[model samples]
Target chain A: MSTEDILKQTPLYQQHLSLKAKMVPFGGWAMPVQYESIVAEYDCTRHGCSIFDTSHMGEFFVDGDAVKSGLDFLVTQPIKDMPLKTCRYGVMLNEQGGIIDDLIVFRIEQERWLIVVNAGTMEKDERQFQKFIRPSEKFANRSAEFGKLDIQGPQSRALLNGLIPDIGQLAYYAFDHFDLLGANVLVSRTGYTGELGYEIYFSWDRTPELWDELLKRGARPAGLGARDLLRIEMGYSLYGHELEENICPLDAGLERFIDWDKDFFGKTALLKKKDSLDQQKIICFISESRRSPRQHHRIYDQNQELIGEVTSGIFSPHFKQGVGLGFVKKELAKKGDTIYFGDDKNKLPAEVVSRPIYKQGSLKS
Target chain B: MEVVDHYFYTKEHEWIHIEDDQATIGISEYAQEALGDITFVELPSVGTEVEQFEQCSSVESVKAASDIYSPMSGKIIEVNTDLEEKPELINKDCYERGWIAKLELNALEEQSKLMNAEEYRNYLNTLE
Candidate 1:
């Protein structure tokens, strides 16, 4: 199908076009790939402030007690204990233990919650929630009613504080209701770029005004191309690439997010496969040269034996080198192991390193 | 999309300026703008023999990688080493400082297959 037919547009579509952004199809959305250049935008986000249009992501609102609403059994995290005005990152899994999607749960109030999910998996995620939580009133899929803008960088908090003073009090993984441009909105201190940033969820129609105001405040416009690079530099997994239908949370190096004490959809199958040694493993690597290892590129050991394949790769402007995250055999997931990444035409040497290759981030600051 | 009057162009968006038996080669401005911010370039080794319209080198932008094709059959006399550290030169000055390679022309007749400034301008119009 044509991208124009399947892909959706966000409220900032006109704004991106005004900046002459390079548009590309991403997650069934007509998203901007870059404004000036990906490298330039990446550098801007690392040093100054950058704004991203994240309105395509799905948002759901459910109203009930945490346990009584079947919310605790739907996700891998213990959400009942989450404080009001706080957000928790977790995953939703299928009965076979495979990941459905990774999501963030926002505790808006004692009886109200907002769940954000990936754009591509919105329909499936909504269906799964509907099937499992047979509530008196169905959970509201409010994805279309809201627009998301992410302001990220070292100076992100200060830049946003100048616009909305109350946002400065928000701690990491916390959110609060604030007034901006005469509208009450939800602002959260969370982001995917491993930078000190805030994600603002506002009324859909007000996005144009917010976009212009943020730009006037000197926030550079960043597109999906730089967004992917920024996230990969932090070793964050993209939904389809690193986490997929056949990949379980444990194999994806997300065991900490899964709570074994509570019962969930994929709990039984995950427990059965927990101790097994034969599983595809997720690992991060850094290239020896500036050459990047692209997605689906074959990863080999020092002896030239094929072991893994890259899921997401990019030339990190922050480090001036190439970094990638991929899945490999469990035996090949050791740190400090030498590896090769390439296609049939060329092969480049690399080293398995710890996740989040760029360590000097202001994410927790 | 600046096309020099004296240069000959290939369908792959490569431009060549031939003087006597030597030629300078680089991607067109249209090509560079389409590729976006070039981060890396894999240059061919000196003395490598290349055929007309064949792939000689590779240029990688942050978004994707593209093969740079040779406009005519020749032997590579020299490759641009400056691109290894600053591939952005290709985006800044594609025609001059960003010249990818110098080829010692072997067959002068291969120039007939390329388009002149006016023909290339019309050729680009067809693409749009």
Candidate 2:
């Protein structure tokens, strides 16, 4: 299929083109891969402010009391206690204990909630919500009605404060309604990149204006390439990679998000797997060599025995090294173990280090 | 974009500079620009024999990996060891210092099958 035929365009598509972004297919959307260069854009995000078009993500509105609406039982994270204007990060699992998608739940009001999901899994997520949410409760899939943009970096707050004076007060994981360009929009202090940033959800029709306004304020345009690198540097899992239909939260190192104390889908199966898990999905690593271990690259022990495989790998611009996220046998998932990655033609030495390969982030600041 | 007047070009964006029985090879500037910030370059061993248009080496950028094809059949006489430590050199100067390998040409006649510098520039325009 032609690039435009299979890919959906965001409101900022023209903007990206205007900036000479390298556009590529990502999650069935015509997304920008880079504006100037991936390394340059990555640096811009780490050191300055960068704006990303995240409109491809799915957004759903759930309206009702948490328990009465079946919203409380649909996700793995505890949502009933989430304060208004706060967001919770968690996963949605199938009956077999495999993850459906990792999602973020935003508490917009006492009876209203907004759930954001991965772009590729939008249809499935909507179907699952429709199937499980009680018919008596009111909800709507508002994915098409909203456009999302993420403004991230150490200078993000300073940049955003120029547009919305109170944006600086929204602490990490918190969100609030603010007036911008004569529209009341939702701005949340949360991001995939481990940088102090905000994810803005605005009216779809107003997105082009917001995008232009942000660029006018000196926020550099970043593409999906930089986004992937930024997230991987933070040890964040992409949906299809670390979390998939065949992987459960327990094996994916997301046990903390799963509330075993309360009932939810896949709870019983997860409990069963928890007892028999031979391998744990964890973020393991390699050195700063330019040689990156790509997806599905076999992970081997010091003795060259295959133990795991990389799910996501990239050359981190900030660290100037190769880093990856992968799953390994439970015993080999330790932080300080040595490992190697192998492909058909090469076997490179590496070491298993802690997640979030680059630690000096402005995420909380 | 820097197609040398005396060099021959391949559709895959490789360039060859032939002098007598010896030929120098590298990817075109357009190819390097498309690849973006090359991080790793897997250079071929010095004595490796390669066929015309065959994959001789691999180049990796932050986003993807691509193979470098031989523009002519030859025996690899010397590989660019500088790329082992500085792959970005390919992005900086893909035509000169970034040349991937030096080869002893086996079939000099194959040079005629490749495009001239002006022809290669025209080919790039057609791609857009």
| Candidate 1 lDDT for residue B59 | 89
lDDT of each: 0.90, 0.88
Model 1: per-residue Cα lDDT over A70-172, one tens digit each: 8889999989999999999999999989999999999999989999999999999998889877584748899999999999998887788778987778999
DockQ of 2: 0.76
Q: What is the Cα-based lDDT of residue B13 in candidate 1?
A: 92
User: Which tens-of-lDDT digit does each residue in A82-136 have in candidate 2?
Assistant: 8999999999999999999999999998989999999989989888899888864
In candidate 2, position A276 carries an lDDT of: 88
C-alpha RMSD between model 2 and the true structure: 1.9
The prediction achieving the highest TM-score against the true structure is 1
State how far residue A34 of model 1 sits from its true place (Å): 0.1
Q: Tens-digit lDDT track for model 2 on B82-106?
A: 9988899999999899999999999
After TM-score superposition, the amount by which residue A141's alpha carbon in candidate 1 deviates from its true location, in angstroms, is 0.4
